[model samples]
Target: MSETARPAGRVDTNMAHPARRYNYWLGGKDNFAADRASGDQVAAVFPTVRRAARENRAFLQRAVGFLAREAGIRQFLDIGTGLPTVDNTHDVAQRIAPQSRIVYVDNDPLVMAHARALLTSSAEGASVYIERDLRDPGSILEAPELHATLDLRQPVGLTLLAILHFVRDFEDPYGVVARLVDAMPSGSYVVMSHGTYDGVPAETVTKLEEANAASGGLSRPRSRTEFTRFLDGLELVEPGVVPIGDWRPSPGTRPPEPADICMYGAVARIP
Candidate 1:
């Protein structure tokens, strides 16, 4: 196992980390009472929060499959990878192409606690975990684990699933993404899903913000314009930038009635 796969410090169950809180919402057992409480509060106001999360996860699965099986992408750099849920990026990609490589990144310590098995790789492929902050995309791009696992000269599927909100106003989220994309080769793909305020009531947005603030303290949710700005120079895949459920849902996968599909998703190829 790579040194980055080990848990850093002891897990802190006292504070509600976003990754664990999200896991709690998805009905996973990796979260604490604090996370459950926070998650419950968020769900109370916006009942579709859970559905949105699930849809986002489904989008990830489909996107990774498309990358590995269709786009022939063999390496994945999955940033903001929350808890180890079923059908993780590596699992989906490697299942299709056993030689696929994946590197999961997140700053949350709880994810690190579960990082052991996540770092396991197929004999034909490789997997690694890195506990790096998204704010410093340069650090993530420069990490030894990432450098060793991915080849910058080739196409890589960079999935920023449900994570851009954690980047506040001062963080230069666009520049952060731009830096990461700029370092990769042209054929690389950028998969993004961000929490947005589109179609949601103003007060509901306010309440959700307040709830998030109670724990993580005010994660800035972006607008459609802001979210699209991330793909400024890239070529967007069919269905353009739309709600998470709007992005190429497989047959039989019903779209959620647009209550709180308060998130937008898209896949764009780096030019």
Candidate 2:
């Protein structure tokens, strides 16, 4: 499908979209010049950002591996599904269990343009994409594409990695998480990774914030205490919420310094 055919309106290459900027950070070529500029600005303040992005993707693969291989989760609702990269949730899950079903949600037209990459599933599995915003959990939960691909009655691995930080306090991010978690069955899982200003130097945080603000972006890094509220009623898995790199790192993988990661990741069971 062409960019102009997206129902979300025409794609604006001039604007620095978070997904496109993130694509630039991850070394993907689908982003425009505006996205590269925004990504460069953020990287200038936090030189480890590119490393953090790669580490975050590795964290996602590990988390999904655990969910699919160990936890036996066959359904996934990956909201804020950014530009496709290696080992996406469906790829990881379907690799372990070929029958896995996944529904990806995102509002970015650029992401939608690359939906084909995310939609490729094994013969025994299924994948679908929904052009929706994270601010509306009700709509995401009610989306026909989601319901059609995934059975809400079964356990679902809900992933919100590196996306909630964009959902500011006014949007009640905690409430949004609660709504999605509430919709899942008892055995459902919530896998998340959120950016934090905790260990970073104050000056670096300030510069990053200023750059994001100048680009018409919003990023609110929460404290460990504040971040925990999003998984309030769920039962946390092993090594509960910790720095992304520290969360079940694969053997021989040298985790970056906690100060450099600047993100917290965790998996929980909705009992």
Candidates in order, TM-scores: namely 0.94, 0.95
In order, the Cα lDDT scores of the candidates are 0.86, 0.88
Off by over 4 Å in 1: 1-10
**C-alpha root-mean-square deviation, each candidate:** 2.2, 2.4
Q: List residue ranges in candidate 2 displaced over 4 A.
A: 1-7
Q: Judge candidate 2 against the unseen true structure and give its global Cα lDDT, from 0 to 1.
A: 0.88
Per-residue accuracy of model 1 over 186-231 as CA lDDT, tens digit each: 9999999988877888898788878887887736778899999999
Which candidate ranks first by lDDT, i.e. highest? 2
lDDT tens readout by residue for model 2, 1-271? 2344235646789889878888888889989998899899988998889888988899999999999999999999999889998888888999899999998888887797698654598899998887878999887887767777888888999999999999999999988998999899999999999999998888888898899898886688899999988988889999999999999999998888988889999999999
